[model samples]
Target: MSWEEMLTTVQESLITYWDGLVGSLPKLGAALFLIFLTWGAVTLARAFIRKLGSKTRMRKNLTDVLSMLAGTGLWLMGTLIALAIVFPSITPGKALTTLGLGSVAIGFAFKDTFENFLAGILILLREPFAIGDHVECDDIEGQIEEITIRDTHVRQTDGQLVVVPNHLLFQNPVTVRTNRDLRRTTIICGVAYGENVDDARSVIEAAVREVDSVRNDVKDVQVFAQEFAASSINFEVTWWTGSQPLDIRTSRDQVVAAVKRALDDAGIEIPFPYRTLTFNEPIPVREQGAQDEAA
Candidate 1:
């Protein structure tokens, strides 16, 4: 074709395409408006869920989890709405396929974390131990301070805070000392062998009773004649105290002090270990030269 004819044809084609684009501008604006509405709705729903979660009976961990899930749901919904508005041809099946492919890698990356998360959730639901309860697990003894979605925080007796993964906690044997109404503590005391055992036992029992914090429901303070030691008579004084954080330590100190005072008053001695050594007079050793000269 001639150059002039080709130029005229290109101009007509451009004019027609521009007219079609102008016609669709209103539809595009409406689609954008719909996307904005969907976003606002999702945001409102997330806010409402967060508010309700804080006020509900759910535990702190569960509340956090639920709020996260609600927010994620809103995000996913808003994403889908925007996708539908902008690209009506794309289907959810493609999104599912993409997610399935990514899920395997994500699982491997967070395997331990996922296990702890589930374990924490189960623990929160079951509530085997509450905050401030003394517990022993796998030879690690501590008081629980908080239960989180991935770990349980325990304050050790030595004042160190430990973060234990919930999965291991579930698998191991956990001994909760203060789960009941009262926990017992035993302070073993011994007196001099010459002291009367019955009198010593009575004194220890009275000391246990005098501690105002000690529980009365305890099956009597037992002062058993545990053993006959070389220096002192051993007696076991086991008594119960109310379930308080430091009740065991408090009761123990009180009982030990009282017992010492009582024994001192009665002239019963808490004897320390003693050893008596006797040495025979040795023959005088002579020097080699002196011995030789004497011979």
Candidate 2:
């Protein structure tokens, strides 16, 4: 084609497209207004949901998930409505068909993301553990700080923060330490072999009971001679205490100190490892002068 003919064709196409855009301006404006309206509605709904959650006994994580799902659903509906207004032929069915066709590629590209998202949803629904619960999952043990759509945030005992993927938590065994009000803790105390077993047991039981954090209501404090060790007899002392990790640690510390002092006061020996060596055969003794002559 000649240059003048090509220029004329391009000019005609531009004019036609400009006229079409001008005709659709009102629909475009309505679509934008609808989207903004949906956004405002979503915000209000979220606030209302949060307010309702606070009034009820529902978990914070569940409330957050519910709010997110509600907002996403509303946005999706608004987007479809806007699209249909802009292009009357594009219906929800058609949009879904288009998504279905492209879903395989999208799924492959974002497999882990979707997996975590689904897992997070399941976890929130199950209510296995909540924020501030002390949980040990796989190799991670910490207090749950936050639960998100993709990951969970944990604050470890050492003050380190860990972001754990939700899929791992869902798949693995999780130990929720704070699920109950009380937890049982045990300590092994060894008394010298010469000490009276009954007396040592009594002393340990008393000492553990004296600890302020130890739960005394249940009569769960127990002391039993477990086994004979290499150096001393071991007493297995079990007691109930608060379920928190700090509670267990503090109670244990107090129990240990109290037991040590009580035993020392009672003159009940807590012995160190004692060993004696004996030769199987007698050896001849040689004087220093005799060794020098032999050399």
Name the top lDDT candidate.
2
Q: CA lDDT of 23 in candidate 1?
A: 77
What is the C-alpha local distance difference test score of candidate 1?
0.80
Per-residue accuracy of model 1 over 1-295 as CA lDDT, tens digit each: 9999999999999999999778767757776786677677767776776678677755666666666666667667666655655566755667767777998899899999889988987887687888878899996789999988899999998899999999988889899988897877787788988878888888778877887877765556767889877778889888888766577778788888888998898888899996777769866777999989999
Candidate 2: misplaced stretches above 4 Å?
1-37, 57-61, 282-295
> Given candidate 2, what's the lDDT at residue 19?
100
Clashes of 1: 0
Q: Write the per-residue lDDT of candidate 2 for residues 58-91, one digit (tens) a residue.
A: 7888989999999999998999999999999999
TM-score, each model? 0.66, 0.81
Lowest summed lDDT across 10 adjacent residues in model 2 is found at 211-220
Model 1 Cα shift for residue 245 (angstroms): 4.9
